[model samples]
Target: MSSEDFPAAVPIPVLATQPVVLASGSQTRLSLLRGAGLEVVAHRPGVDEEEVKLSCKAGGLTVEETAEALAELKASRVAAKVPAAYVIGADQMLECEGRWFDKPEDRAGAAEQLRALSGRTHRLVTTAVLFHNNSRVWHQTDQAKLTMRTLSDDFIERYLDAAGDAVLTSVGGYQLEALGAQLFTRVAGDHFTILGLPLLPLLGFLRVRGVLPS
Candidate 1:
């Protein structure tokens, strides 16, 4: 986006408060926070994502439950250290039918995901949690449904060649904001939520908590 897009300068909060901490090492999430005018401190809590998901499934948790559980675990893991400081934790899950899909492993995996999702609608369930002083203060989960435009093998190949290894980073091998937009015929939900953070909801929590100027 260009400066012209934000002609009205955003008011930067000038207050002495603990910096907001992000509990995951996601560049996209960091960028989102910065774009929203919040001073953020990102901390990657080294937890096993796969293990958390597996445990949720073993316990027969629903899609939203599973995502929330993962977010809580991530925030709680770091909350133990940052007393009185707010830490944000987020998690996203891709579900097609009854199966959970993860980021593709390689080109072949990307192609496989594209094939499975061709002409089908899938849900991306994202959860965001705020933790303070070892307590769960606020959290939310949003569901986004995207219908893939019928994909052709040739187009998939071209997309893979253009996107390269980046496709391996997101479930369904697509980023809705970039070249991945070409893969979808329709999407229903807030764009930020689809990207993995429900910015408005999270920001609302911060405002209510006096973390950001009300």
Candidate 2:
């Protein structure tokens, strides 16, 4: 059969099984929802991620807590937009020691990030919150610890040359699932968690909410 004539695969199960709204402007999050067979409409929350992180840091919240709060904020914002639909909001933070890392603004910033994370185990805390009818029905946080191998200045430069602006997209200077995989010596956590969703738990929540077939 020609590619166009091939039947579509069955969609992944989701709670409600009905269409839902996803808050935030992340393509990664959108792809994750699509992979799970959910009909998701994307809504970008107009919050400044950096500002939220700074406020959370000033308030002395842990990285994990900050991530969840931001997720909730995004969900709340979008939930207001579509009051009758189920909404999902997600946020991620990278922390080393007590320091919070923001998304690098440029290649130089990414290089600096790589240098700071070198030879250290950093935690990536990803949080997701579900809102329905303007109420938070469920939430979860997935935390992953990744240790980056120390690289020489030459290697860092080469990596930056190869990865370019892609490095600035995530909180850390690398995308573990791509070419950035070469930068890590050890990683401990669920693959989905590293990707910033905690898929299984989120799926479980969806199933319990009747959004996915039981």
In terms of TM-score, the best-performing candidate is: 2
Show where candidate 1 strays beyond 4 Å.
1-18
What C-alpha lDDT values do all the predictions have?
0.89, 0.88
**How do the residues 167-201 of candidate 2 rate in per-residue lDDT, one tens digit apiece?**
98888888888988999999999998888787889
Error of 1 at 129 (Å): 0.8
Clashing pairs for predicted structure model 1, backbone only: none
- Tens-digit per-residue lDDT, 1-214, candidate 1: 8988887966665442447888998889988887787888888889898888898899999989999998888888888888678999999999998989988888999999999999999999999999988889899999999999899999999999998888988888998888999998899998999999999999887888887787
Clashes of each: 0, 9
Question: What's the TM-score of every candidate structure?
Answer: 0.91, 0.92
